[model samples]
Target: MKTLVISSSPREDGNSHVLAQSAIDGTVRAGHDAEHVFLGDYVERMLGNCRHCRRSSDGLCSLDDRYETLLLEKMLPADGIVFAMPLYFYGMPARLKTVFDRLFCYTANSAPQQDQVINGIMNKKVGVVISCEESYLGATQGVIAQFQELTRYLNQDLVGVVVGNANSRGEIVNDPTDPVSAAANLGERLYTSRVTDYRLDTARSNKVWDCSPVGCPDR
Candidate 1:
């Protein structure tokens, strides 16, 4: 399967990014094609409310911007999309949230003249990878609810989430094996499942496919 991983952390090698890399690594190891897009590396401009002007026919953004051509193009036709971001003040990062905001062109806020693509948002599964400073990782419920609401708008499935405690660059690598193992299994589950029924709380606890009876990579 083709998977698109979006890293929303601004740090060059932050915890969020480390978890994202692990997920990408697991995806490739499972024989799937995975590509990562670092939001920090891109120039995603903040967009305003759809002007609803006759110029709406121009599916492109009114402002001459980079995302209009680059990241937007990649988002199209991907089977699955993963969002990796560090929790910022109990919520998503500002820039990443801006990317989500820009995607509103596909929805009700679209300008009347905006050249919005028909069925611009449909038929994709979404996942999340998060690394927080707290050891207990207490924000899964809120994050899952947020993703669920957003996915409803995009008509996408909220497949799963991977939350790991990470305070330093690459610290997650040395952290407990369960979350990382859970991440790898999540990649495999995405490949095998069809209807997307996993719950964030249970998935993290069940540790599906993390390790086999013999301790081999279950994936």
Candidate 2:
């Protein structure tokens, strides 16, 4: 299966980036194709919204920016999606929000009308990998909530969520099997199309292939 990994941290050597790389490693190791997109690189510049996207029937954004190249054509057709991000000010960054905001064009399967329906963007497996300073229970609550609402509306399957405790740039590199291993585990699960309740700090596994004989392990 093809997996798209959206690395959303501006810092190339930051904790969030470190985990992102690990996730990509896991994805590549799992024998799947991946497109690594650094949000900071292609999304640094955003065009002013003129709402031309709303008029299109195919959910095409006429914003004349990279959204058409990066998100619509690339992200939509991917078999699995992974959002690698870092919590900022207890929420997501403006750039990441920009991407989500622009998705309004594709929020539905058809144009606005009685026959309009959810586009089912969530049918593909969704995974979240977060890096934040605080390791508190809900440090990534905002990200999780966004995914919850997104998956619910899109009818997508949320496969996994991995939160890495990190602060300074490259702080997670020194840390043992945390953001590194945890991130990889999340990526590996993308191939199996299975959601795991595993945590890096507590439960860590090296298996990437489907191991369950009774069917999908957890939904």
Candidate 3:
């Protein structure tokens, strides 16, 4: 199996990057091929230019940027994807969000191979690791909700989510809950487990991952 791990933190060696690296380590230990990409390095290349132009002859984005390469070469061929990032004002960083936004090209009417693009992106195993400063009950709710809807729309299986509370760079290692280990475990599950549907359970009482320090209040 091949897994693509994308870290969206601008700060090198930050808590989110550490967690992402741990996930990659787990994936490799599971005998799966893992590739890591730092989205901060490609922010300038993912300009959401797809919205302005029609799809190319190959039914891919018309932009001459790296986004098309990342999508067609790295992401489409992977069996699973792990998104790692620190919460930015209760949401994902702009660069990471831009990547998702550019995916709209795959669904555009001009794309000749829309079904192929859809199949390439959908029904894959997905994992998420988030680092946030606050451990409040709903601190990560916004981002969580966004991923849930995204996975649902893509018909992807969202296998697991790990949330760590860390304010400073590389502070997640000091977190008593040890979300780093949880993230690694999630990566292992991404390679080992097979689930057709891992959609969000609306009836679930706790929306927050249990690893949070403060923990979610019982509803």
- Per residue, candidate 2 scores C-alpha lDDT tens digits across 1-219 of 888889888887788877778888888888988888888665654534436434455444455557656765677778888888889888888898887775655453443421322343547888888888886777788778888777766667787788888788888766654668978988877756544445568665576555676664633
lDDT of 3 by residue, 1-219 (tens): 999999989877899998999999888888899999987555554545554665555545566557767777888899999999999988999889988887777667766657667889986899999999988859888889899899999988888889999987888999899999999888877855544443586454443344465764321
Q: Of models 2 and 3, which has the larger lDDT?
A: 3
Report the error of model 3 at residue 57, Å.
8.7
Task: Give stretches of model 3 more than 4 Å off.
Answer: 45-51, 55-64, 194-219
TM-score, model 2 to reference: 0.76
Which 10-residue window of candidate 1 scores lowest in summed lDDT? 109-118
Segments in model 2 whose C-alpha atoms lie over 4 Å from true places: 44-60, 108-120, 193-219
Model 1 clashing residue pairs (backbone): 52-111, 52-112, 56-113, 56-114, 56-115, 57-113, 59-115
lDDT of 3: 0.82
Q: Candidate 1 regions off by >4 Å?
A: 52-59, 108-120, 194-219
TM-score of 1: 0.77
* Clash counts for the predictions, in order: 7, 1, 0
Cα displacement (Å) at residue 86, model 2: 1.0
Instruction: Estimate candidate 3's RMSD in Å.
Output: 6.9
